[model samples]
Target: MRLRALLAERLVSRGLGETRDTRPQASRLPVLVPVGPQEDPVEAEADMRRRLHAVPAGTDLVLRTSGSSTGTGRLVAVSARSLLASARATHARLGAAGRWLLALPAHHVAGLQVLVRSVLAGTAPLVVDTSTGFRVPALADTLHRALRGRDPVYLSLVPTQLVRALQDEEATRALRQVDALLLGGAAASTALLSRARAAGIPVVTTYGASETAGGCVYDGLPLDGVEVALDAEDRVLLRGPVLASGYVGAEPGGGACDVGQDTRYHDVSLAGGTGQGIARQEGGTPLWRPGSRLPVTLRPGFHLLPTALPGELPAKGGTGTVRVLATPDRGRLEEGRLVVLGRADGLINTGGVKVDPGDVEDALTGIEGVAEACVVGVPDQEWGTVVAAAVVLQPGAALDGAAVRRCARELLEGSHAPKCVEVLDSLPLRGPGKVDRRAVQLLLSRS
Candidate 1:
């Protein structure tokens, strides 16, 4: 109910009371922390209230990313402007802001955005009770009830949800009726996307993170104000109003970004402003053009980590006049559309050679009967780190470890081939259905 009340404030004033005329008299506003579906809601809300002073003023929502993906742990601070910008952009893209069905956890940006859209549209969002877990029948039943009105209803989900939904005829048919079904949080396998489309489900592949206030790009195209660019090393750079204000430290010892301090690891000749499809280098020099590769240089300064990740890439607010996020993910422009490869941090470095697991996974999935694949780097005595894989075969399909290796070698041979492959019934997941690479690495290490 408190979450809904906070969302209601978005209606009375512009951007959660950030407007000049309607500003509240409070010196510091309390940060809104969403409770997980299964968590004790009363305790979670009380905990957030107790530590209200830690969060800086002007922060609207505080969200945390899964520990499995990012190396560190911290809370993402999103301002009202960023959230509204993201929600409006989505409504504009979908052509109408109608009803929305929330299938993801409220703690996640995707699920929060669903409520935002519903609030903006003046309709209470129909939520599928996902506390126990995702069930196709519950999703189908809730979606059925949500579709009674003439207003177009929308659904947001991850790849794993769609995989299970396609198995049931009622779930698949119910999903097909949604105005637009968003698939994100993790890469959708080629086979999964094909099956969803063949089943007549409207699946729009999304690309973004909690740092960007959910997905700024939908189906290979940037949303209204969102811009996409690549730095010299092909690291994805994003800029727009959708970017979060900054991040707050999780606690005293989370090993994440420091709260209210210098977050920059190295000094860069940075110059940028708030806009679309354009980025500024030093001296206000425009350096990036859409659908083209542009290299932004980083001058040597205080280096913390050796990884190509901007050491601790400051958030849109913490940085400076520059508001771009240098995402760990790597991507390339394909015929004017962004094709994201695997994350740069997730790359397997074997024998001093860098290998992208996405390339290997894509190659493996190209083989017949291979449903999905996750490639990781397990510690090897000789190679320092060697490639390994976990695969989920298509239903009723039989495959062995050798066959999976052969398929991987056929396309990405040499150092990219998996040293050992584990054929699991399903890949392990964390958060809203992202592959748990850390778990995969641990499992492959034992084998």
Candidate 2:
């Protein structure tokens, strides 16, 4: 609430009239119209005004879920209090004093956070028009102009934007000038991260959502007062000061389930998991994992699991498979350092063994003629799903599928090798800069 009040005060102070009430809107296809000096602010304000006036004062703003890949709509309401808490937590995490270059859309939480952070940090964010799609050279030029005063600059971008920037010499140079480049909204590929680090970009990957006030966890670490724990099913659950008041339409559960309570349930079902369990109690219903259910006891304040599930427990102790449920794809904590593995969906399941495609992709990076390769699983009567790779060879480079398979065999295990290789000019990439497996399957089927 303090953070929301602070944001409202800041907006009002910055010439936004008190009559104008800022409200968050949720939509399956949320439109993010980038307004500039040339655009009509009166019209823009009118549109927002109409939306805010339509909803009652107590009504929460339901924003669409960040990723629409699953075709499931998750409406996350950003309360006035949660918005402010996020700003404060972000301010505390990322020290004050720095201008932010906003390339992300305001409709999404990450972009909204950048704008809010700018207001809370006492600096207005410089917006870049990515509506015409990302133009690395143009973006770099705008960023260079924005940094004319030698002021420290900060920017937030998804992995795709970062990868495109790295491919452009001008953009890459421009990125090196920034104080920090926060990457989130989706998982960044290992190839992309390695390239950024090599280019000397101060890149930081953030994890969180609109429910947690945006990026509560930066680079695998939680922000101040943010608590992280794995439920019995190994799904990540978060609590602490940064949590939203509650979703709009959802009942006001009670005191213990009120503001600052565990306010999120990340669906890890795709990776073979279930929901975090719940416990019934006076004044509140406790939510947790069912099997490893905690005692029907009340702890006055917030608590975090010291380590991730399957982390504290011995690896080989259980009879069932040692399924490692990672919240973020590709990263494993080894000796306290986060080593990313890419995305879980990107993993290739061959012969009943899981093969992280990233590892195979890394191995094939330096191979001759192979420009880009995406490993995926294809329906097989014998193997259920066998590893298949879609490869894009460099211009004028002759590609031999057999040679590529031989190369993979030399670098990876027999089960991990691509069982079938389909050569293409390019791979289908999604909005987040990840390989669009569905599109690839369609292309493969046609071929």
Candidate 3:
């Protein structure tokens, strides 16, 4: 199967599954897939056989961002501690350990995380081969058997997969039976999410990336021991046990926070905080937001974990204490939960003003006739770079290009409104569910 072909080397090297030895080996240096989204997986696996590969010591698994749709990628080294920290935090949030239904591509961070989480769960995950495309019947059959297990069953799926499943009554029924459906990999519309939740499906929208070992924040809340901070530019700066060591081959990142020092408890140099220590309310939980400054030197060991139950954590590797990994995504805190706006690099510069395309996309999708929208900056002599948009209208809905721009102006600032709007049958995708913004830029450039 494509899943095995893509992930066999990674899984076997990590010593996963009863099919393999599945034993933790301390001598094992970090097993790196190390290939970016656009690289060949077969070639990446071949790199595993080389005897001379080198990376920072204590690094466990090295993965890359599947920026396939965004036309970007980064290779990050995630230490053993960090991987487990991410897995354990997920368990703490989900409230139970069970079989994970792997629905995303195995090479992707979210799917790779299924392996990491399964190790802690002590239950082998049932994987679906997504390389051939998502089949609703396959999902139905798998969920049926998984639901029969003694332990609770969990499923991870992209929003596109969920959309497909929602269309088939059998698939929808099977999905409703799972523990919690993790919806991520791309942004889900408010209309789609509301419909899923309203249909008795427990849908949890996740926010995070490969740098954090996948989905560190769930449904707008940071996981246990994971802290979220915003840089001076309002870009998200992630810290704590879930953070990756840093990008592979990049120069050592300079941040205000230094980690792996002597501190079991979390200390703060955060933005929107009152005192030196993290402020606590009535429940004794520290308020993660409202810090005084956008400090990138934020270290780990933030939230207190639950007492060790049997198999509460993967009994492997060292502590994942490290400095902040600054993300390209722009975000803000609302009621202490992180609200990711869009990519910082994706901001459009027009007439000396920067506009967030994510904000524009949100406004566009909110319109009645628009089914999907992709926003990008198009080069223009007058404005220098004007906000341009490409949209896929709902089936049978005829939306005029001018009407689309008029609707956008009503919902957002003039600068945020699309100067050029193009209608398309569908947005080009670089991978499953993710929009190819760069391709959309090329398409919008022609308009």
Q: Which candidate is the best by lDDT?
A: 1
How far residue 38's Cα lies from its native spot in candidate 3, in Å, is 11
Candidate 2 or 1, higher TM-score: 1
lDDT of 1 by residue, 49-160 (tens): 6644455445777887776565444577777778878888999999998888989887888888887777767788888987678888999999999888898889899887
Ranking by TM-score: 1, 3, 2
Candidate 1: worst 10 consecutive residues by lDDT?
299-308
Task: Give each model's whole-structure lDDT.
Answer: 0.73, 0.57, 0.67
Model 1: lDDT of residue 84? 76
Error of 3 at 371 (Å): 2.7
**Can you give the lDDT of residue 126 in candidate 1?**
88
Number of backbone collisions per candidate: 0, 8, 11
Cα misplacement distance, residue 443 of candidate 2 (Å) = 4.2
**Comparing candidate 1 with candidate 3, which one achieves the higher lDDT?**
1
Give the alpha carbon lDDT tens digit for every residue of 215-247 in model 2: 777777767776554433323446656664333
- Give me the overall lDDT of model 2: 0.57
